[model samples]
Target: MLSLSDLRQRPLNVLCAGDVERHETTEWANSDDIDVRNRFADLLQRAFHA
Candidate 1:
């Protein structure tokens, strides 16, 4: 598991919870979750609007 501090070292816009989870189980490499992509897009939109 990646510590919060490790995740914080990079730009938040390019990282998400799944990236850390992938590091643990390596299953995300085959993930097809559109919801995650939508969430990231939403976050990016919010950041840009702010």
Candidate 2:
């Protein structure tokens, strides 16, 4: 199976993914197609900082 960890090690200029269903965001995620940019941003912030 393919994964971000595998791809992260290769030489690449860009990386992307979609469809994160966070259980905590139930109150604001009124639509399935909604773009949760802030949620991903927060995750990335924590990922890099930690």
Candidate 3:
């Protein structure tokens, strides 16, 4: 069977992509279809810095 060490060896980029996808989904749900995507971008930056 695979060991815990093997799991830890998984690619880091995969984890990052999951986080990015979830963030996009959240922003889309809270935003309107007409406005610019800038607000979402700004919110993400603020959240990261905070």
**TM-scores of the models, in the given order?**
0.39, 0.32, 0.32
Pairs clashing within candidate 2: none
Residues 1-50, candidate 2: write the lDDT tens digits: 12223333334314535433324444434435446645545555676887
Residue 17 lDDT (model 3): 35
**Candidate 1: global Cα-lDDT?**
0.47
Candidate 3, 2-50: lDDT as tens digits: 1112223456444333322223446544666534355555555676786
Total clashing pairs for each candidate: 0, 0, 0
Q: Show the colliding residue pairs in model 3.
A: none
Best by lDDT: 1
Per residue, candidate 1 scores C-alpha lDDT tens digits across 3-48 of 2234644675356655443232223323477665565556456767
Query: What overall lDDT, based on C-alpha atoms, would model 3 receive against the true structure?
Result: 0.43
